[model samples]
Target: MATTTASIRVPAPPERVWQLIGGFDTLPDWLPYIPTSELGEGGRVRSLTNEEGGLIVERLEVFDDKGRTYSYSILQAPFPVTGYLSTIAVHEEADAGSSRVEWSGTFTPDGTGEAEAVALFHGIYADGLEALRRTLAAGSAQGS
Candidate 1:
């Protein structure tokens, strides 16, 4: 299993940031791979994504929102892998003007058992998070 974590400090408050990150259904607007999501427990999530020469199907696993953390698993997707779990956490800053957002995912290759392929998967994880950074930055600016 491989794991990666990416975080960003959004100038927007946690509540507003959650309106973006914590809201699963609107991911496609900011995140490239995620085209759309269905909110709520046991809801269906769909996305328009492509990986390499193949198409990507989006499947989302939603957790009960009780605290400052949310988590889910990718039960179905267009990847050659399984055991996909994604999580997001929101932390309020002491200054009260910003929030710390963190997200991460873990998965295993569906067919290949090679370390190199897994490494490539990890690389994508990093890239995807970086893309989120840009998305959040834009959102923050627009909100301001």
Candidate 2:
């Protein structure tokens, strides 16, 4: 299995960061690439539509509201991987006013080399975290 992890520090409290991303179906709320998400299976599953109209289906594996974290597995996607499992967590930074958000995934390469697959997911996670940072910054600017 190949794994990739990306993290970013947001200038917001952990609770505030979790409020935006802790939900299993909240990808669209912060991920500009994912424009829409529909919850099914009583909110255990999410169907996401990307900006290019590509579809991705994911199932929530675990959720810990108190811990500000969640784990999910991709049920269907266009990526070249299988047995994908990912976790996203928000942790309190030493600076009480800031938080660290981490996104990580593990998967087995399907139609691609292990290095290529790792690069792909790592890029995705890094880009996603950057997007989260921008979203938080925009929100903060508006609130200020």
Candidate 3:
């Protein structure tokens, strides 16, 4: 199996960050690459459409609101990966009102090399976190 992880510090409280990302079907709200998303199975599953019109289906495995974390497994995707499991967690930082967001995933390459699979997920996670940070910052500025 291959693993990839990315973390980012956001200038917001953990609860606030979790409120934005905790929903299993909210990816299109902050994830720029995900243009659209539809929920199914009582919100336990989500069908996401990427910017390039690729479809990915994922099922929510665990949603721990108290822990500010959630885990999901990909049922279908365009990437060369399978048995993909991902988790996203929000931790309160020592900084007055900051939070640390960590997103990590493990998977086995379906038809691609391990290095390429890792790199692909790395880039996706990195970009998603950066976009989330920017979105939260903008929202904070507007609210203030």
User: Whose TM-score is greatest here?
Assistant: 2
Q: Which is better, 1 or 2, measured by TM-score?
A: 2
Instruction: Give Cα-based local distance difference scores for all models.
Output: 0.64, 0.94, 0.94
lDDT of 3 by residue, 25-76 (tens): 8898899889899999999999999988999999999999999999999998
* Model 2 lDDT per residue over 1-144, tens place: 999999999999999999999988888889999999999999999999998899999999999999999999999999999999999999999988999999999999998999999999999899999999999999999999
Quality of model 1 by C-alpha lDDT? 0.64
Candidate 1 C-alpha lDDT tens digits along 1-144: 766677767666778666766665656666686554445444555434443434344455555455566676665555566887767787788878788877777777668664754566556656665676688788768868
Candidate 1 Cα deviation (angstroms), residue 25: 1.2
Is candidate 2 or 3 superior in TM-score?
2
Model 3 regions lying over 4 Å from their true place: none
Q: What would the TM-score be for candidate 3 when compared with the true structure?
A: 0.98
lDDT of 2 at 27: 87
Task: Tell me model 2's lDDT, rounded to 2 decimals.
Answer: 0.94
| Model 1 ranges with Cα > 4 A deviation | 36-42, 47-62, 113-125
The pairs that clash in candidate 2 are: none
| Model 2 stretches with alpha carbons more than 4 Å out | none
